[model samples]
Target: MKVLITGAAGFIGHALIKQLSATAEHVVGIDNINDYYDVELKHARLRDLEGIGNFTFIRADLVDAEVLNQIFATHRFDCVINLAAQAGVRYSLDNPKAYVQSNVVGFLNILEACRNFAVPKLLYASSSSVYGLSKDVPFSTRQSVDCPISLYAATKKANELMAHTYSHLYGIQTIGLRFFTVYGPWGRPDMAMFKFTKAILEGKPIDVYNHGQLSRDFTYIDDIISGVMRLLEKDGLEANSVFNIGHGSPVSLMDFIRAVESATGMTANCNYLPMQPGDVEQTWADTQGLFDAVGYTPSVKVAEGAARFVEWYRAYYKI
Candidate 1:
């Protein structure tokens, strides 16, 4: 199968492409390689995929409609996976335009291309942040995600709505995976997992948001890839569907820090801080819907996942 995966250099996108290419699928990946965190890290991800025979990488921004359209025209991909977006809740507070341009305008271009090209299946990444401000434990796809606290969450919620419209109007099978706190090797540096690990290793105090009161589902990257692969391989899914791809077990901020410390064999100096803007106290996902459809659920626990990430971090940095 010929597949097109956007955000090729991203945490999830990089891992997904590696797995798909290993299966001998002709996978084309595209990324703008924006200086959101570290451009060299993004380059490193692309470099790692260099020797794969079935993989191809293109450097392009999603908002460039002409380039994206040309790609669709040339490839006529059997499946399109749209993983590109302006991520981070706190970053969205100061730079709301980035979220609108990348998540809103860029996504519109992707939907248009899929509609015009008549692509049969399109799977896109959504986020657990969409469940903002709802006291709802184990946020399910059935619940109303009408109230979003951050511009980031608002854009993701908008993606689901836009996808539903296209699926109804154009008969495209659109699947939205609401990923929860995805982390592991090649994880984004802006995320808690990477940040905490970096600080702890360097003997710096790790900032604990919400005064150390936050909790997250903390789904591992490998399990996320497995879930996505299951959906891609399965047939006859609903034309418009969204699933909460998560570990289904929420890990507390303190517990997560402890796991990091255990993995690194160093105590973390915690710096307690009030909640930042566009941040939530907790995120828990009801993954039953995903399991029902894909026959898979995220299985990695935080302790094991943290150890694996630290191992990679040490080796990659030669720390």
Candidate 2:
């Protein structure tokens, strides 16, 4: 099958493309490669995919309708996976426009292209942050995600709404994967795992947000890819559906830090701080719905996942 995956250079996008390219007849990946973190890291990911024969990479922004439309016209992809977006909850507090432009307008463009091109399936990345300040223990797709604390979360919730509209109006099978705290090798530097690892290795203090009270369903990248692959290959899914793709087990901030320390063989100098704006106290996903549909569940525990990430970090940085 011919597949188009946006946000090709992103942590999840890059990893997804690597696995998808192995079986897909043709895989086209596109990324704006914005300087959200390190451009070199994004470039490094693209360089790693260079040996893949069936993979093609493009540097483009989702907001550029002309370029995106032309791409759809040329490729006429069998499936379109929209993973591109402005990430980070704290970043959104200061730069709300980035969230709207990339998450809202960009997604709208993607939906339009799918509608015009008659693409059968469009699976896009949503976020657990959409759950916001809800008292729900394990965030489920069935709960109301009406109250979003961050602009980023708000945008993601908006994406789901827009997707439902398109699915109803155009008969496109739109699947929104509400990703939990995804981490592992080639993970985004903005995330907690990467930041903690870097600081611990550098002998710098790591910021323990919410006074070390946060917890997350830190799903490994491999498990996330497996879930996405299942959704891609599975048949008879609802035309408009959303699933919480997560590990279903939440790891506390202190426990996560301990995992990092165990992996790196170094103690993390944690600087306790109050919760930052647009941050949540915890995130735990109820992945039963995803398992019922895809027969998949995230298996990597934080300890194992953190070890793998540290190994990669040490090897990649030669430290």
lDDT of each: 0.94, 0.95
TM-score of each predicted structure versus truth: 0.99, 0.99
Give the RMSD in angstroms, all C-alphas superposed, for model 1. 0.7
Which residues of candidate 2, in runs, are more than 4 Å off?
Answer: none
Query: For candidate 2, what is the lDDT?
Result: 0.95
Leading candidate by lDDT: 2
| Residue range with the least summed lDDT across 10 consecutive positions in model 1 | 17-26
Query: How well is each residue in 1-319 modelled by candidate 2, as lDDT tens digits?
Result: 9999999999999999989988999999999999989999999999999999999898999999999999999999999999999999989988999999999999999999999998999999999999998887888899999999999999999999999999999999999999999999999999989999999999999999889998999999999999999999999999999999999999999999999999999999989999888888889999999999989867899999999999999999999
Q: What's the TM for model 2?
A: 0.99
The global Cα lDDT (0 to 1) of model 1 is 0.94
> In candidate 1, how many Å is residue 162 off?
0.5
* Total clashing pairs for each candidate: 0, 0
Reference-based lDDT, residue 259, model 2: 100
